[model samples]
Target: MFYFFSLDFSLVVGIFLFFLFIFFFFLFIYFFFFSKLVIMDWEIMSFNGFDIKFTFLFDWVSLSFVSIVLFISTSVIFFSFYYMMGDVFMFRFIFLVFLFVVSMLVVILVPNLIALLLGWDGLGLVSFCLVIYYQNFKSLVSGMITVLANRVGDVMILLSIGWMVSIGGWNYFFFDNFFCCFWVMFCVCLAGMTKSAQFPFCSWLPAAMAAPTPVSALVHSSTLVTAGVHLILRFWLFLSNYSVVVVFLFFVSSVTMFLSGFSALFETDLKKIIALSTLSQLSVMLFAISNGFCLFGLFHLYTHALFKALLFLCAGTIIHCFSHVQDFRSLGFCWSKIPFVMTFMNFSNLALCGFPFLGGFYSKDLVLESFFFSSWSIFFFLFLFFSTVFTVAYSVRLTLYSMFFMEKGFVVDNESDSEFFVVFPIFLLGLGSIFGGSFFFFLFFVDFSEFLLTSFFLKILIFSFFFWGSLLALWLVFMDFSFDKKVFINYFFYYGSSMWNLQFIFSQFFLNFPFFLSFYYLYKLDRGYLELFGGKGILFVFSWLGNFFHYISFKSVLYFFSFLFFFMIFMFI
Candidate 1:
């Protein structure tokens, strides 16, 4: 028995396995505790003689952003479990949600160009996938167009990378590249414009409403769309060199802000209104980034995520309850039936309107302050002011029309009450919109009071204007401003006239001409080649030559080999 025990190895293996289990159990416990107790430090880790640096630096900027993203994503996932309970493609939805979270985390973590591009592309891919997940042909087409348009901007970024490699070598993809990185900075800003859905590319965002509500919330608010603003903030130092690029960004952002806001004013679809509002709000962030108030931009991004996600989730609940009706004009007196949803949606709309003491007030004030200090152009200030007014106008219009106004022919049947998971996120996000900024200031050692005072009376003046604007819009909407066909026509005429002015002419002549010329050259080349070798000329020549070569080579070689073989055989015989 002793000899048998000595020879047996099974017990030794069992013991080893038991020890391994214990080790893994202890390791799991250690990591769980570490994740709870340890704050991620901003540091550089090196491997294979290459250094990768990142800051888990929970500053005012990163902390605010990361907290908002995680909160919104987690809430949306919680809501999805119930909202998508009976869905066939629930797993696919969750997969995209996880992918979005991972992409956003990567966007916030990596500190260099290559890593940033990785995150950027990842977000874009996830967003495009989510947009077309319903498998509708129209939605898929929109997603394809969005992907292709954004890829054009990505190409600029790739070119910028090559330019950086040429100018500063491979090691200069980090923060240090910004010191003299004007060209790369320009390319990156262009990329940001496309990613954030500014100007001509802004159409895709509104068209993306074919996606489910949760996807719209996640894409527009927290993760993918904000990647552009993240890129700008991550490379703020680089952008400072090209002040003209900053101004260009500002102009594009400002124009898109008002354009989308006004477009939202006319839109009746609940989700499209929200989508347009998102474009406008995102433009505000880009505007902040252009003005060098990156922290302010980040602050706005955090709050916007909270409120916008809340609004979208509430919109989802409404859509689900109303048998998929999405038009604000089609909804009437829903505030009484869906009290919780009404209250939360109002909070979100108010926050978006930049009401005092709300999240938007502070961030909007920061943007106004940045504009005042950077360049005191009256046109810029007025554009900001009018955009704010329009933002208020549309927010009130959406809320009032959807909740209070009674349509003559439309009646809503609210069959389902919003579940706990959906209501909980809305309440939480509303609460955050109220206090998140203050908490961020404390966490990051940021002196909000001083920063608030940095612009002195300008901030107060802007706040007053926003306040009055909201009041005026409220009054006008409540007074039931008649929709005059002539006014719309006149407004269209004004915009058309401005568009056809000098800028339009210049764009057509200088910018568009090159594209036309290239197309013409390609056309000429095709025509010339077709005329020179029309029909079957080249094919016939090639065929004739092939037959000649085949006959000459195969027949001649076979006959010569046969004769030589016969002669050898006869000699042998």
Candidate 2:
């Protein structure tokens, strides 16, 4: 039943995606080649009194993004058949994924805040379901954190919706002076940051890895994380004018990139490392968008989705084969057994490192090179540079741990590449990892006139980080830097492993503290004072009143009979 259901769903969505991809690919070409701009908005419905409409926007950005999303989602659905083969609730899982895809599409296609929230809220609601699919305590906690953090964004969007009411309608594109609404822009940016797992809301991304690997591939790559970037991209015209917000966004995103990359270096869990990298790449996209590199940011968003999805899928296969062990330290030389999966894994790892000509290189190079000539400060430039360096270092570290080191852990000899469902989807994404960047580069960067001309050294500045980062990785891998000093090790672990204490500060302090207070209040107030004075006290008061009334009624009946008897004796006399 599961196989049949999965196959049918894949076939249907695949055909639909194929035609959509071709249509949009040509549509993009038509719009770009002819140097024409077109935005087609269709109103599905119109309410009477208030005059609100359900509208869909079809433009080059929406079309292209929809195509990419469809492609990735279809592939993920197909891949889930293999990854989730043994699950009893395969049907539910597949449908949830499909619903997630629909929600993402809704978010991508709708321009109006009202309609966009429909999709935005759907993404959050469905993600909560998918994250806690395992039904365990860890998954539940992760799901709560993920949903609560995103709820902050949802509230912002809701506030933006309410703010938009003053302007007659919720279509932000209709008004040119939307930037004048400072609170609205603030809400939009905050919503995007929370959705994208920015510096403040980043703990959820790593925590969300408790979800199924397939969910991670889809959510972290295309749908949920990128939704924020897409939101900011749509509102860039208004957001760009807010200089203070833009500078703050730049700072936040740069710090996010650095912190996430740095944390990935100390991360031992395979899935958490990849999750942190996703957070880092997301920061890159937001940084570009903040710095007015929306074109490069959009380009990078597309390419990063392809490679990151591939990386997660590859990681999924490895984890599945290795008894679900996600620690790289416990895994080594996996290529010796599952050579084919490992081969594709390397392709994704290299792509993530932004190797020349791969999918990531085109966007990463464009964003970095453009930044070099921009008027931004040198401090952020260093932060981003080191972040890029850390990216490569961690990529190399991941490779060494998984490919070069001796097989130090348990071996499952039953691993094989015979699963057609597994290899086929991976092969498709692998091809994208190899050529998706170049294809997207031509389509998107046809006219990079805004990129200032720079010297040769400046041209390869981003490329040079790869070399230095690799050297750092090599030193860290080969050197005996293990510390015997307990305090130093504690501090190192505290800073590195805890993401500069963001996990505790944000997760434990900000979120968990409030939750703890609630629990304490439940114990001290609801279970203590409120329980006595409120529920139990009311019950006791009612019970006492009932007894008092019964005794009064009995006394009244006896007195009435005595009075009647006395009246009857007087009448007889």
Candidate 3:
């Protein structure tokens, strides 16, 4: 008595086994920590032949990212305790925070595409929940759009998975197949571009600033966007195959970096500016990753997580202190009053601008070096260099205009003191931004004895140039560079006008396009064509003829013949 099973059964069993393994592992880890156990043993858990590993297998790459995610998340949670202390949705917020952490952990731990997709969609769901938690009309609207856009990426990921199965068979979704993987690689890369907010997909990130500052800190800086780059890094071997794809990725990243940096400079809203900067910095990491500098990209992601989260937390502190005023124009010199906040803010901004000796400087220089070595195209190098300059310029503008400079209309209420919880994370992140990269370098990559003796002159040159650029921006802002209003209007109109701008063009060219002939069918009132043949249109005629034949063939003859044959077989058996 043997039983035969279908492929579907095997699929179900495999999924169940994986699901149970993850569930029990999470439960065990939680209980171990909860029971105050100090287990020092490290080992890998295997399911079938695959290693379900834990420990310092969480190496340089994994540790760097995990630390950043957990640190930022912890900070956001701490800040939320203050930011939303008395709010009615405290329990809900905490739940979402935990959900986000769990999803991120799953994402980082899983080495298989199926597991990765589970975590990816789980994170998406959690983020959507966080976004719409307030349940306001604005949040609801933004949440819908954000989820919808993300779903497009999700579908792409699913298609990529299907392609993987079709091409490489079921066994090829793991780390071992990373090399020699092509179709799945391309689809996953496409999904990542959308998820990471590259170019056309970037509109949703800035719009997502509607969420609370703590949510912004966790979602924008530390976790969600970073996941996309993490995915690319996780499968670097696959991506390395298509050098053209890598170059295209670099180009998209460069465009996103410059555009978002410039947009940040022009933004009046504090959160929106930070949001745009997040997009720009993430693009920088993606560019680095695409150029075959996975470690450097991860390093930048780690450092940016710290500094950007601190920046947003500090911004949140200022916003809360000022009764929710977020405009730079309305914020004035508070260097003396909120000295701690200002210090942390300025430090983070300096890090963001890639100041020398800071963590950002090390990671950013590595990114630049990666680009420089990967190509001899001077135009590409120059584009990257100028983008860095613009990064410094906008960061300086943000710090100066908001914290140091005084505007006539700007005022601060005396009651705005930074809370310890909020200030603690800022201080921690500030320290990390100052020292984390060097510390990690020694611990993971090299000893001081093995460190290369590089040209200090180049470092000095780069630092001095950025410092000068920052000063130039400061001087320009102080000088109040003036333009005729008419000139500005002309420039705006000339460059910004597009098909997107013209309603008549959209109606005539897009709406009335003949390929959308079905749309006209909906509006047409004349049933002359239907009435001409008295409901016997082409489809109806075919349907009636088919039915008449079926009644004669199957119902009259075929049905009786099949029934008689089956009855005779049954009787004989």
Which candidate ranks first by lDDT, i.e. highest?
Answer: 2
Question: For each candidate, what is the lDDT?
Answer: 0.70, 0.85, 0.70
Clashes of each: 0, 0, 0
lDDT of 3 by residue, 380-435 (tens): 76667767877887788777777667643434544445566666667777787788
Worst 10 residues of 1 by lDDT: 5-14
| Best first by lDDT, ranked | 2, 1, 3
lDDT of 2 by residue, 1-573 (tens): 766776566557656765766777787667666766554556555677544457777677887888788778767877787788767787778778888988998999888898899999999999999999999999999999999999999999999998887777788766566544778888899999999999888998999998899899999888999999999998888888779889889999999999999898888899999999999999999988887889889999999999899999889988888888998988888888788888989999988888998899888887888787679888888998899999999999999999988887685644446587678888988998889999988766566685457788886776799899999788767542455546865566458878888877777777777889999999999899998899999999999988876765586888667767888999999
How well does model 3 score by local distance difference test? 0.70
Task: Determine which window of 10 residues in candidate 2 has minimal summed lDDT.
Answer: 476-485
Clashes, model 1:
0
**Better by TM-score, candidate 2 or 1:** 2
